[model samples]
Target chain A: MSSFLVPFLFFSLLVSSVFSDQAAFSSHLLPRPLILEYPENSVETLQTQLRQFDADELTLQCTSWRVAGEANNLNPWKTIPDECLEYVRGYVNGKGYLVDLQRVADEAVAYAKGLQLQGDGKDVWVFDIDETLLSNLPYYKDHGYGAEVFNPVDFDMWVDKATAPALEASLKLYQQLLDMGFKIILLTGRSEAQRAVTEQNLRSAGFQSWDRLILRATEDHGKLAATYKSEKRDEMLEAGYRILGNSGDQWSDLLGWPMSTRSFKLPNPMYYIS
Target chain B: MSSFLVPFLFFSLLVSSVFSDQAAFSSHLLPRPLILEYPENSVETLQTQLRQFDADELTLQCTSWRVAGEANNLNPWKTIPDECLEYVRGYVNGKGYLVDLQRVADEAVAYAKGLQLQGDGKDVWVFDIDETLLSNLPYYKDHGYGAEVFNPVDFDMWVDKATAPALEASLKLYQQLLDMGFKIILLTGRSEAQRAVTEQNLRSAGFQSWDRLILRATEDHGKLAATYKSEKRDEMLEAGYRILGNSGDQWSDLLGWPMSTRSFKLPNPMYYIS
Candidate 1:
């Protein structure tokens, strides 16, 4: 009787270990390509299923997160989390993207030279912040959801709390252009009142050199026609800039006239346009 | 003989006064609108006369000048004297054109709000700094004749040496928008390397907030494809900004897609775009 009991106990332990291993594998598994099987005459159903699957993947990979101190919160960005960063780098590089720090710097320098050639008082370049020149990834990661939207009040606090490390390559490139004699104009959508904090951030990030830092005017009292960019361009042209180039991470930055030399796009797949 | 001499002296003084007045007027006066009169049979003559007149005006107003007090003798932004500023303002106002500063600010804010509503991570507001935000008239006045074409290298030095004073109304308005949470981006044709001095100028002028400050990439490489402002808008859009608005003194700022929320054109008659 004693021998039979020992054998049974051993078998039970083995089973438990197998189950635990399965659970772990399921929880931590990375994403994989999905396959779908559909019945005949189910085109709509299949399409819907595929879309939902894609959305699920996106949510799982891009949106799933926890704030600091939350259970299972591993600080994705900081961890460089094995597969994620590699995936990002691969994706960017695969696209023939030039995140090559030197290349970015060189591009900036070249653009500045073009502006010099234009050499008009009206010529100027406007830049967008937040991913254009600085990386706010860590901050977002720490904060957990990207859905809260950018609240200026909160943003000012966040920027003040956060320290943006210069995108070394982009920064050097910018500095080189400055040395080449281009007037640096910082046009941003940040509220005009956060000037102090914003300026502090730029300085801290080593972007202390700029000709004019123009923020959104808070005193507008009109129909809000959505043509402010064109107006600003007009103002710049009126001021005498041939406007050799303009740069930003958004389509709006490149929308207005005279066109920009080249619009460089930075990666920000975490968010979507409204 | 005495009577004749007295008359001669009076005539000489009159002639001297006329010449003196003409000289003073030339220095301070805005160019008067010229109407060409051609014989009915000579359309070609009319065209030639018009072209010559336009050329003359362009030469007088847009001529490039050697930058003063710089090692490289770089070109700096041309100075539009106070008199010129006043004249330009008058000319535009007389033509029933309003700068519409408040309207511009409001439109920009609305556009930004729209983008935020869309959940876009990108934000941008491309601006022409000089006449749009700060007044460079004083700099021009102080430097005299040799301050016409924009010289990136010299301008950087000047920005470093000079203190920027906020254009009172514009600053207040800009600050208000910043407090509302817009990302301020400054795009200029200025060289990239002068980032430091540009920041100094912005801070001194009370434009202390910004997200990204992009200058013209002025190195040996070829010029950017889009003109500065358009490229900036494209960058903004690519980054996912809905592009709230753009403000500038010229039409070039408004030439591209995803149009801004009602462009604000500042009065600038000292120069014109082709």
Candidate 2:
């Protein structure tokens, strides 16, 4: 071998050991190239990889934006930042997303298990629909994972198909709650007009049944999600259904007066609602 | 060379390329080996590495515990779970914490910049001291990043040192807010007796002055942070100050009635106040 090649080969020998170890040690939080989206060129790929490795300013900023929303520190946000599309894409499609989802589910179940139910059959678990029970990832998979401005018309078109799948972690939680004898209430911002398809989608997705699948009425239009959900929760209260727990992706679904006894907010780094 | 060595050598060639590109791409969120703690045995290291690699259940659960606290989903948590010591260590000592801190600071600044100031100088910004402005991380660093249950006597001894450093991002934000003509209020759960040391520490940490440093009086003892802070905020209003913005590391510091126009919560995965 050439003199220069000797040291180069020695260095190569060292790094291969590290690579061999990663396979055994890879955590789901680590990025996996599971998406079959057409690959970008080497330059773009290298730049993106380097950016993530360095934990660049913009990457942290984007993460902060998403996390801030989750923490309810940042409210009334519109779309994910234009620069953070790929970050959001990788996050939503990656194992990190599942880890977050499963984490909330585990905690929620633990919380449920600890409850000494009054057993009046009025104990209800409130869940938001989209991104809580059913996922619209099939639609979002094409829509830039919320980098694009939300198009309600296009989203409604996707909803019309009623093909969204259950969030696997949430599905398990839903079933577990049912077995625990808590009544289920699906309080969603989805319009009442979508009730037929939404119900069809819910049943097909293994949700089985809910005592009440509350959706927005015509009068509920133009109200903020927080305001609308608050009113619905009030009605649930008046109906003698004790809201023992509430689960949703948006803080709006979790907050407001007459809140749940415990609220489990699952991860949704994609988008925000008021 | 032996035939077996030939394939192994070729594999090494491919792996080294991945490591070289990592330096450029390192983000603040990536784990960094900054702490000088001695390394564990290879077997233990490998076991941990493997667990994190699969995004194993326990790792995700611990992350959930921490994230749930940030989301206010988990309340009144006691300490970092025994199973998640290393995860908490890695996160607190790693780049992720700084990324979280800097992100909050940046967003807080953005929000501050947009305010149409009344120019009354009575518009005050309320700040939680520990973990919000001054970082007690040096203490927590030795305390297993909260794996150990909190020891008030030990913690108080550390606080009495009056040597805690300013969170760099918060320090910058403080300077900028002062420059922008906003009155500063330092509200903390620290006691009235510790005022001397607290003020000294604040000055030493680049916090020059505050319109008010509202620490707990003897009568304020036994009240929860939310209650105490709320009452104090009411006092601020009574004293003719407009709380334009509030920032903290705990929800207790942000919640309660008479909230600020905007509340900025910095990240604190190590502990939860309420």
Candidate 3:
């Protein structure tokens, strides 16, 4: 090589080494999982249980819970009498809880409006499934019944069999938003594996008129276990919904919007932080 | 098999088929690349020529340019010239033009305050690399780069040689934020391949005081790119950033905040989108 070429080559090698090292470190810190396990229990059951317990008590108990471990103290295997589970489920699944429902609905409505087309004048709303539009109360309630630890396989099975009755007030509000020419987008954390059952449940519950139904990408295992809501939110933002408002029971769903933008939170007191 | 087993088998087969179809469809639709490309020459001398244009005009033109393939009636390739290339390089490498430096510094200060131990009050700011804390203008401008096409080899070479002077203002802002008990965070989008160079570049730029320098995970092909930001944002939020403001050039970076947050956008008039 020429004398000048030697220096160039050396610099190139240095740069290449630097590039490789940075890439390696990043991967080390942000390792992507090959499979994402969706905990079987629904947010609804957790919400109901939270209602049953005092907030201060739960917070204290949670403080003792180790956030990272093979054991999840959040869902202890303690059997609740079937009668009690059924009663709580009924109250949670039924209507007349409009105050909380309206708060969430109002948020969703506001999000939908914010996403309304700028000059097109068309309105649209995108909703996420797991902890957003519907509650997974039955699955978790079953967990309480059997007093079992959270399991992905069992959760998938439950989702297939699960009947999602809308958080009544949310349904009415969503319908109202749809009626006003706002396009309804049903985005969910449910994997492509549960797409059919999920869509079936939505249709059965009268959520069939949505403009689009997006299920989580199966290949996105790295994100499945965490941050799924944000990924879906990006898709919604990309689709240009002037999101006037968004409603979800999870903090992740509402964090992406501009300040004072409408985001309604339903009570999901059962479990905190996915 | 027994009669009961036969019915169970049939049901499983039915369910499996339904799931398979949905998975196939979703995989086909949702995994598209988010960035687009401009003509090879479009970005050629942009930095140099851009010096004559006001920041607002530069930003408007940058965002308004059609992707290479979608340029409607305009020919981006026809605009390049050798003389203007250095000028473009100057702007791409100069630190004098960023308008959001102070804003980023202010936001970082609030974030640090939130994360401090009651009286510790040390400040820190975490920033994403691509389109966030640094401008990749020269790399693309040198190659007249376009988004639809990703040339990893050439891209890597450019990144290796890339110097980020525009970021000086942002870095200075980071320093100010740090002076108020805040630390700096150098988050990036470059995969594992660019790790060493990224770190060296940061260090070279006098950004040795960062709290963390997180990088993108490479194992899952960045399927969770959107989620990565949210997860990090949540961590910051949990850390108690009082007025934790995030700065990024992409919408994905700002997706999940609950408050009316502040964010500063450094112009990337070249070509990028989440």
Candidate 4:
């Protein structure tokens, strides 16, 4: 063999061996399923048991229990069951909850930067009022979170006080949005009657210079929260405002047509709304 | 400043400018929402219309329309409404649909490789019949997809003929699994009465050896497809089989406990079963 051909032949031999080894490995590499084990009991029995402790049913049950505290001989915050307490405590006090919001905000900021748009008045951001911008910790702290009934009468009294603190993560995001030249619009399920206190509470909590504040009128109260929120978004679209961003704690606030360009969800496992 | 410090000072200045630029960018970034536009009508009115054309109702409506063809003075296949035909056509004939399946399969194969397990007899893979392993294109070609009614009698006749072609992608994956020493198990929603033809059809479609072929019994006909499939998986777990992988055309076949180590889904927008 020629001297140059010998080196070439040796390289080919090494390459063939490597190729054969890979082929053998792939042929022997049986793929495994992503396995997850079942609970100790049969699924049917477990499902039946699950039906008894339904999350929605328990939450509703607790809501009614708290609402009718004196009527049912229940204590103010004492009636919250042990099971729900852990979840509620974690939401109110957990560092992880705040961290989650911060991470989403960080990603959302990055995404916003990439979009780079001309700031016409039509370029807008929609924010859900209660938990999205302002913290409801004070009320939930005193009244019990999901453990007590949600009383509109008592809640309205709290709302009027206009003292709920700003949700720090959302507040930071709000300032960033304003700097981005996006018009800010606040949409809330709060009644038209509470608009003044809502405005005061928001302004006091460090939210400033929003373009619009929409609240449901007396006639709109009969509508489902999802239906009502969806209609408001539709109404905004009809008015020729392009909702670029929407942040809410509820899925209903985000779903439906003429949706915003993107949505950011803040954690609110404390309660679920239809 | 010393000459040595000049370069370091210049580098620090450059780094600070980049850091400041990022900070300024983040401060002005406004995240957009995931937007979808409405058809011409208002969302509320559209939602109301959707309630009337509910999925179950539409499928049932089309089924009745197809079965009673000619008897009801409707033309064969021509009776299928334009809207339903459009959806069915988009699903089956669309390049996007096939591309989606291929993408999912690639991911599933990668996931399966990572799971690396002993190829013991206990290590098994479960696959749904019909849309997962074999194509019903031959049947659907005549039956008008979901645009026409599904007739069990006619479908059974087609099955007995055993001419349905193998779904090439899934077949390739199946061969790979077998080569890797994983035992293949076929769990189909097809009834036990059709077992003989099902076996013949699978074999003819290039599916070599599988460890088991489970079909629904006559008694299981009353059970919901999901319930029946879940129970069958439970039975396998009880028998000490470790389901490492599952591929199905429907969510029902993949859900319920003792979940496979990994699951691959192939698109089947043709119809939905409860």
Candidate 1 ranges beyond 4 A from true positions = A1-106, A111-122, A145-152, A220-226, A272-274, B1-274
Q: Which whole-number lDDT from 0 to 100 does residue A168 have in model 4?
A: 91
- Candidate 4 error regions (>4 Å): A1-82, B1-274
Please list, in the order the candidates appear, how each scores on TM-score for chain B only.
0.54, 0.80, 0.54, 0.68
Which digits, one per residue and each the tens of the lDDT, describe model 2 over residues B1-274? 1111223333333233324433332343124442222133334433433342333344445655666778877757778778777667666666667777887788788889998888888889999999999999899988888888898899999999999999999999999999998999999999998999999999999899888898999999999999999899988889888998999999889887677878887888788786
Off by over 4 Å in 3: A1-98, A106-122, A145-149, A224-226, A256-261, A272-274, B1-122, B125-274
Give lDDT per model, in order.
0.47, 0.77, 0.47, 0.63
The TM-score-based order of candidates, best leading, equals 2, 4, 3, 1
Model 2 lDDT at residue B167: 92
Residue A2's lDDT within candidate 3 is 10
Best by DockQ: 2
Alpha carbon lDDT of residue B62, candidate 1?
21
* TM values, all candidates: 0.34, 0.79, 0.36, 0.40
Candidate 4, residues B52-128: lDDT per residue as tens digits?
23432343333222212211112113234655564455435644345445645655566666666775688888999
Give residue B272's error in model 4 in angstroms: 24
TM-score of 4: 0.40
For model 1 chain A, the run of ten residues with the poorest summed lDDT: A66-75
Indicate the worst ten consecutive residues by lDDT in candidate 4 chain A.
A67-76
Better of 1 and 4 by TM-score: 4
> Looking at candidate 2, what TM-score does chain B attain?
0.80
Q: Cα RMSDs of all predictions?
A: 33.9, 10.7, 28.3, 24.1
